[model samples]
Target: MDQMMETKKHNTNKGQKLNVQPLRTQTDIETAKFFLSKNKMGKRDLLLFLFGINTGLRASDIVVRKVGEFRNTKKPYIVEEKTHKRRKLNLSNLAEQIDEYIADKSDDDWLFPSYKDRSKHLTVNGVYRMFEVLGKQMGRDDLGTHTMRKTFGYHYYKRTHDIATLMEIFNHSSQQITKRYIGITEDEIDNSLDHFSIGI
Candidate 1:
C-alpha cells in the first residue's frame, strides 16, 4: 500500500497543472454521463455533470449548494463564491431531473453530499477528481471541472451566436475574452484562413 501511495504521489506531483478542455461534442458528453452514472459517482454525479453544463456554475458553487436552494424553485439564485455576485440562474430546463433527485430529501441535505460523510457536501477536490477520472476514461487529457462551464459557454454560443448575452452571462470584461474562453478564437482563425484565397 505504501509503495502504491508513493507512486501515486509521484505521478500527481509530476503534473502540477491540469489542462482541461470543454466537452465539445454531444456524443462525448453522453458517453461521459452514461459511464459516470454506472460508476462510483452514481446519480449525483450525473446531476452535477448535467447541472454544470446547463447552468455554467463553478464546481465550488455547485458543491456547496443545498437541496433547499433547488427545491420548489425554477430560477434559483446564488451568490458566486469567487465573485461574490448574486446572480439569478435559470435551471427550468432540468426541472424534472432536479425535482426527481431532490424528492423525499430534506431541505438541509447537501445536493452533492460526501460519500463518506453525509453531513458535509463533497469537496472541490472530490468533484475535480471525479472529472479527472472520467476524463481519463474518455481519453481526454484536457478534462476537469471547468470543462462543464466551458461546455455550456461553447454550446450556448453555437446555438445563439450571441456573444453579448454570453459575455453578460459569464460576466466577462469583453466579448473577445468570451470568444477566447469558448474557443471561438480558433474558429475565427479557421474561417479567416478558409476565406483567404489568392487569385492566381
Candidate 2:
C-alpha cells in the first residue's frame, strides 16, 4: 500500500498521471453538475462534460468536430477523427437540450469552435481550462479535464465488467494500461477484499 501511494505521488508530481478524484459518489456528481450549471458557463460547460463523459473521448478529438459531423439528426453518430472509427453514441438524453440550445447556431460552425475563428474548433487546452475553472469553482482541487474521461472509463468498466470492451473503447493495446487508466490502484484491491466473505 505504501509503495502504491509513493508510485501515485510520483506519477502525479511528474504529470505522468492525473490525480483525479473519482466521481463515484452521488454527491460528487452533484457537485460537478452544480458548477457546470452555473450561468457564467452556460451550455458550453455542460456540453463539454456531456461530450467527454458520454463519449469517453479525448478532449482533442471532440474540440475539432464541426457541426456537420453531428448535424444529421436522422443518424446521430460521431466519426472519431483520431481512430477514424464512427461512434454511434446515444444522445437521447441531451439531444433535445442541445438542439434547443443551438436552434439558431449554424451547422458550418464548430461544435465548440474558437472565438477567433469559427472555422476552427476549440483547442484541447481551451476545454481543459474551462473544466479547470469549473472544478475550482466547485472547490475540487483534484479535478482536471482528464477526470471526466477517466470517470467515463471507470464507470463504463464498472457497468460492463469487460476489460476487453474497455480496451476497445479506449483503443488501448493492453489490459495493464487499461487497468491503470480505469483507476485500479492498490487501495481498490484492498477494498475488494471486503466483498470476499465466502459463506462457508
Candidate 3:
C-alpha cells in the first residue's frame, strides 16, 4: 500500500513541467535551513538540504550516499547518476558537520537513512516530498528538490561570474542554458530593460 501510494505520486509528477526556482537570496536560503531544521527528521533533513545546496548534487545522487564516502574526507566523490560523470566534491566547508553527523554511525550506513527503516537509504521521492512541504512553509510554490542545485549554481555564478567553469560543473551544452538554468538570464533581461531608453 505504501509503495502503491508512492508510485502514484511519482507518476503524478513524472510528466509535469518543473517550474521551480532557486532560493535567490541569502535570507531565503537561511529561512529554508531554519524550517528544515524544525522538520520531523530535523537533523537528517537539514544535513541533506545542506549537502544539496553546498555540492549542487541531484537528490538522487545525494540520497544514495554512504557515511564512509564522506567521513574524514575533505573531498567526497561520486559518479553523477544522470551524466555518469565522476566528480570530486570539495567538502571543506561541510567536513566538520558531516563528521559530527556520522560519528556514531557505521561506515556502511546511509547518509540519509529512511525514517521507517534504518538499514535503508532515503528515497528520491522522499526528498521530493520533503522539499514540497518545505516550499509550502516558506511561501514558495516554486521550490523543489532541484532548487538546491539551482541555488548553488545561482550563487556560484553570482560570486565568480565565471560561466565557463559553472558550465563544466553542470555539464551543460551552452552558456545560455546554464544562465537560464540558474535564473540569471531572466534577471539580466529584467535589469537591461529596467533602465532601457531610446532617447525618445
* The best candidate in terms of TM-score: 3
The whole-model lDDT of each prediction reads: 0.81, 0.67, 0.84
Considering only N, C-alpha and C atoms within 3 Å, which residue pairs clash in candidate 2? none
Segments in model 3 whose C-alpha atoms lie over 4 Å from true places: 1-11, 14-17, 196-200
Model 3 steric clash pairs: none
On a 0 to 1 TM-score scale, where does candidate 2 land against the true structure? 0.75
For lDDT, the strongest prediction is 3
Total colliding residue pairs, candidate 3: 0
Global lDDT of model 1? 0.81
Task: Estimate, for each residue in 1-102, the C-alpha lDDT of model 2 and write its tens digit.
Answer: 212332354465433224654466567776787777774545766776776777677776778766665654733776676678877766666677667666
TM-score of each: 0.86, 0.75, 0.89
Candidate with the larger lDDT of 1 and 3: 3
Candidate 2 residue-wise lDDT at 184:
62
Instruction: Report residue 178 deviation for candidate 3 (angstroms).
Output: 0.5
Rank list by TM-score? 3, 1, 2
* Model 2: CA > 4 A from native: 1-17, 74-81, 84-86, 115-120, 190-200
Q: Write the per-residue lDDT of candidate 1 for residues 56-162, one digit (tens) a residue.
A: 87778899999999888989889998689999989889999999999989999999999999899998678777877887789877776677888999899999999
